[model samples]
Target: MTTTGAVLRIQLLGPVRAWRDGAETALGPPKQRAVLSLLASRPGDVMGVENIVDAVWGSDVPRTAVNGVHTYVAGLRRALEPGRAGRSSGAVLTSESGGYCLRVDPADVDVTLFHRALHAARRSRGQGEAGAALRLYGQALSYWRGEALSAVPGPFATMERDRLRDLRLTVVEEWAADMLAAGHHAELVTELPAAVSEEPLREKLRWLLILALYRSGRRAHALWLYEETRDLLARELGIEPGADLRTLHEHILTGHPELLAPGAGSPLPVYPGGLPPGTPGPVRLPPVGRDFVGRTEELARLEEVMRGESARGGPTTPVVVVGGTAGVGKTALVLQLAHRLVDRFPDGQLYADLRGADPERGPASAAHALEQLLGGLGVDGARVPADSAARTALYRSLLRGRRVLVVLDDAHSAEQVRPLIPRGPSGVLATSRRYLGELAARDGARLETVGPLTAREGTRLLAMLSGRRLDERGPAAERLVALCGGLPLPLRVVAQWLAANPGAPLGALLEQHPALRTRFGPAEAADGVPTGQFHVIETS
Candidate 1:
């Protein structure tokens, strides 16, 4: 799906609505609205005729179903963009191969906007911006006029209704928690009773409601609410209030000042995922090495992949695969690039080492990696499934609207990082020693080979590491760079040795390591190019 035309606003979260130039443009009939919903649910992805038919008409498809779908597309194109000539290709909804796909900015869809706002709120909360986070969370929740896809009835609507409602409930609880952190206890005291009544089993909501009531000088009401929750749980599931809830009840009974703390400062409800209660920790990008240097082109490629064709819809999920031999600085380069892209992925950054090249341990299973990632995203450990496929599906669902940066280091195969790749504006930077041919050929990964650095780049790296410029020792530094074979890791090691042995000469250090002297003798070897892995093409 591709569009470089006028703005198109399509709302599907609550009711099926389309707007052009801030005016509500009519979207034909029920079938047409269903088609639009199905396509817009997954923008930029082609939906086949059968899937569309199934979603629109279920098993009771008409004999003229194929023709009917074509008619609907034609009608939608005209309704979406009325000026197009007869039989002209649409800029918004394009037909390809077997079916059609909707091309629209994710921000235009209420579902995507809601999710983006939700993540923004989470981030704001993390940064101690409870007021901003509360506003954002409230803006996200406000998108729901009622049950999502409420007006649109079909199998797809039924499926989405349950998913969106659950999400809405979670958002409601999250908003209440943020309000509690922002110290708007009185407001929550008024807002949460009805919500608590709706889902009596939701202990955290009831807890927040109790906290609110207590802080608002309603101690009797707070105790009664807790007792009410305890009785409800016992009556419904034959269990008492959780330990945390019980503890909170006692704290309220004692009139602890801590109970009245800002929602941001209040302890979060414990989730099984080892996350910090409500908010997951900040982007977990490992510290970039101090001595890391010189991957200008590779770093450019990372930026290119992250923002690549966002306007044109170039790659639904852009992936940059950096492949090279051991100690080629692939991981270091990826870390550097990931740190640089922090603002791009505000949802947070995720890193997982596949252990593909570890001698002691085998390559990490995709399922295990998913468990870590899901946990990092604040998913409960018990909530994360055991099956790899299910884990992948859940991971994708979590990543759908959020802009997360995933760094998969030492990946063995494309399959290892495949499920981890975030679709839409999110990106993945995967590094491996082996050339993952399938990634480029089948998975559309932009492959870049990280090779040895130049003689000058190597010298600069050594100087950067040693905390002193080596320009005065130019020829000596050049020889040392050549001697160390321009490989970043070994060169850094050589620099560290030089730093420790202050009195030892640069030449003397190389003379001690015979391998350095041997490789220095051969021009090709000094550049660190293996015979077969990389071929240097030259024309005279």
Candidate 2:
């Protein structure tokens, strides 16, 4: 576990050591190590300098303790990064307004990963994927070698250790539940009683042991185990078993078939029609219309707006709005651009589907979108305001001074996006079917209009989608491109149809769907204007 680029490997069950690269790095007396450990435990959160000083020196800190804290952070960074040549951008420790944050990747920390995996397992169980839930729960439990933060000696260390121990016990209960769901009652008979012994106060664990015993045909032992646990709880804690546990005991006594139902013996609590509890990745969008083809130049231009030289000249709060007709690839271009520039905003990248201008639903309220964005940024539910104006104000306030990238996809108009625009030195990219002229004039946002793909680009796009050499197919590819009207969405749809229907001929496809020709428009340009028509292909 490294904190702020410093390689720190701690074995609470054994020795604790800090290293820089391959060499041992001393943690400047012992007080400094305690301060570093506390900060590392909560990554990405700003810890005030004064609070850190007080933590390390307690009431005995000198008048210059604040300066000492700075020196300690600087030393820790140097130790973590060695000569500093390999220091990552933002490093492990970063300075914010009135404090500093440890920016360690959560995956690199064992405790963090353990908690995350445990949460994932519980969620999987809720989703009715018992096999996946069991695997995840087992993997989470495997991370525990011994007591957490064991080698570290301090009040904070003791508190953290106890917290982790409790969390581990909760995970153990989840594990037993997953095992029972997987129909391993006989195997759990031996395992669950030992777990109950380790965590005697937890009624849930005791309940699981009784259920496992009853299912394994040890009825007398199961009842005896329940009595023993109830007596211990009453004597030690002056409390009765929880309602769930008592209910399970009574069901076992009555020979209820529920006790024999698959997964009934598990102690996993059920959520009340809520989303599964776990760390979920971003939602993936399904493939929209495949008629989309070509537009290489437009794609490149949008890329330039995001990462090219043109993007730098915009206002401090740069805005790039892509507009086009329905099915014109505005959202596609914006999505592609955002994916490419994800690394640019190390702070974070945010995306929202405003669903504005959609055929089914009217435009989403600015206040609603603001609420979603605020929630995504870790704002507590109670802290979010109810009013639109207040929400917008709070959203902008939160965004101020942060270098984040915001993508509002499928917006209705500039009016819908204006209030949603965050202030400060951030970048805002929006997509709309309508040309937002006022946004360009007032907000100095650049507008990029996506047009139909060129003939060659359209052919290439079809070739890419079909996974075949279009040149080998000759006039058929050209005819198909022209038939699709050089529209990417249509071309993709036709290509998918062709790919799926492998035995069909391109000529037959064109002959049966002559309407495609009219959809592509005329071949020749009228006057000096280019023909908007391209060759058409049957999609529906």
Candidate 3:
């Protein structure tokens, strides 16, 4: 297919509308718009008829789905390439290998242009040209008019809408951060409140707005806004303001000079990966087990979510809560994920034991956790704040503009985790016995539930840890895996036992140590064991 001289401009950042040669093209019915929406999502990629059907109709597909797609394509072809003659193969929307491909100049598509502008903005920001970055960010964000793909009916449209909306929000936050860094707080004071209203739960937005208000000499209003935000978060999400907001409030209250100084704070950092060699920063991550295995999906998901903050070039911190029953490897999974993401966060990695579920001492207070985190960040113990809120504020202030990964282990509640969340482009990986739903609802945290490994994974872990060819043991290994309930703690303990008792067969080991059997009894064994066969024998 050859490209026509005329350009077809498709806008998917907002309502799925299109224009050809500066003329508005009437996209047909909702389903047809959905077809175009899907095609436009992956502009050059070929979408098979079956794939289109699945995306458009979801599960309730009709027998005539293929024909419906063909009709939609025919309609789109007519609208997109009006000059094409009748009964002719489409020049723009061409059929290829039993699928359809939408060929268009990427610059003509709003989404592509938006991303290009974002890339340029990111580059400018990286080079410390805050003005140029802000201009580029504004240009990129101007493409968004309303909810993306609005009223376009299809599963694909719904998902794409959500994705594009999130991207727009990220760009907006980055733009505001740049604006603030450029000392344009007076302008943002009137503007950011609406954005905050639209995304009330976004702490980054609230943080920027509060900062703008404070810098605009509206310290009282900023303090009032913090109280309002606190009350709102408490009422809606049952949580307190996150570290960033709390820190800003403290600065406002204490009349911190940094808040009032020119060049108030630098723009958020944009490190692609590791910092240069000899960039000294604390690496406090706990060593992960050498025999760590499984949770491939969970780990991948965590990395994706954590990296997504930087990938979007936004100032929002990514907080991920890894939750499950005790002894199910929540902390292990978080530590593994943190170790994997260390290079991505160039500032450093910080770890703290909240001891939320510790038997000897109850959950560590937020103040103590903040002190530990601040000390890990190289803040002297003597200089740490005496007040809890002041400590949280100071901790977040230290984290601002730095790409650090703060791993909060065994968190007791959302409140405990909230004060510890890092600010700016940093990331947080928190493990908790409780679900900590408030983090997700209030902080935009991604909740990942860590569970026991599958039988195959357990067997692999055992084989790796014990230096045993457990695959050779077949049903006995399977029985042991079931008996361990696939939890890492019990499996590691048994693997260690087998490592010590080298030649003991798996069945004989079970017979020889009745205490081991009692501890890791059958999956149905009840006493002290939680549901899902979680023994709760020890802390993760």
lDDT of 3: 0.79
Off by over 4 Å in 1: 1-282, 309-315, 467-473, 517-540
Q: Which pairs clash in the backbone of model 1?
A: 180-263, 181-262, 181-263, 181-264, 182-263
Worst 10 residues of 2 by lDDT: 268-277
TM-scores for candidates 1 onward, in order = 0.46, 0.42, 0.49
TM-score (C-alpha, index-matched) for candidate 2 = 0.42
Task: Tell me the whole-model lDDT of each prediction, alpha carbons only.
Answer: 0.74, 0.66, 0.79
**Sort by TM-score, top down from the best:** 3, 1, 2
Q: Is candidate 1 or candidate 3 better by TM-score?
A: 3
Best by TM-score: 3
Clashes of each: 5, 23, 1
- RMSD values, in order shown: 24.4, 26.9, 23.8
Model 1 — which ten-residue stretch has the worst lDDT?
531-540
Better of 2 and 3 by TM-score: 3
- For 1-540, candidate 2 gives per-residue lDDT tens digits of 444455554323212345455577666645566666767667768899877876666667789888877777876666555555544424666778888887766555566778789889989888999889988988987877776765664566667778878888888888897787677988888777777777788888888887887677655455556656666888998988789877876665445677773745552231111111232323333334443445567767766765652246333577898865544467777766666666665456677788875556788988878767766655546556677766665566445445567889878777878888876556778987666788999887888866667767777777777757355247778887666666666777767777787787667787855666555444343223343444222321
User: What TM-score would you give candidate 1 relative to the actual structure?
Assistant: 0.46
